[model samples]
Target: MKRDLELLKVILSKVEQQPQGAPFITNKDFSTRDPSLVAAHIQLLCDKHYVIAAQNGDDKWSISRITFDGYDYLDLLRESTLT
Candidate 1:
């Protein structure tokens, strides 16, 4: 599936706002969005090293946090898209 840049930004922002080392739970946080899409986007971000995603202890839900690279990427997007 193609990357959803908008959703990616939302996820990144959420992670950034969260306390350090705290995971942003995907399901709980992205309640209004399509779960599969969110998961796919989070996976894509993780694959690109823009975010860290972790799922443990048999929990079906995964959590993520923005990485330094994610901030850089978000900044680049902001700069490039600004009028």
Candidate 2:
């Protein structure tokens, strides 16, 4: 769970740095046999308010926008990266 959460942070950071209406494929391929883990990581990001998760009528997740709070958090992480 710890590793998954860390990965989620990185993924969200990447998306946040991109344009507003960018398309991010949360699931890359059909071989993603572990849906539970992926969902958990996405939930963690949602709980932390890093990213917005929207489910269309087709049960597919759509990432809308990354909040300003997320950018602020990323900036703090950037400071640590320099050290």
* Residue 68, candidate 1: C-alpha displacement in angstroms: 1.4
- Output the lDDT of residue 35, model 2: 49
Query: Which tens-of-lDDT digit does each residue in 1-83 have in candidate 2?
Result: 55453555565666676675667645332134354555566566668887777654342455666677777766666666432
Root-mean-square deviation of every model: 3.3, 4.4
Candidate 2 segments whose C-alpha is farther than 4 A from its true place: 3-5, 29-36, 55-60, 81-83
Clashing pairs in 2: none
lDDT scores in order: 0.72, 0.58
**Model 1 ranges with Cα > 4 A deviation:** 21-23, 55-61
For candidate 1, what is the TM-score?
Answer: 0.76
Q: What is the lDDT of residue 68 in candidate 2?
A: 77
List, residue by residue over 1-83, the lDDT tens digit for candidate 1. Answer: 77777887777777778886674566457888887777777777778888777744332346566778999987776566531
lDDT of 1 at 68: 83
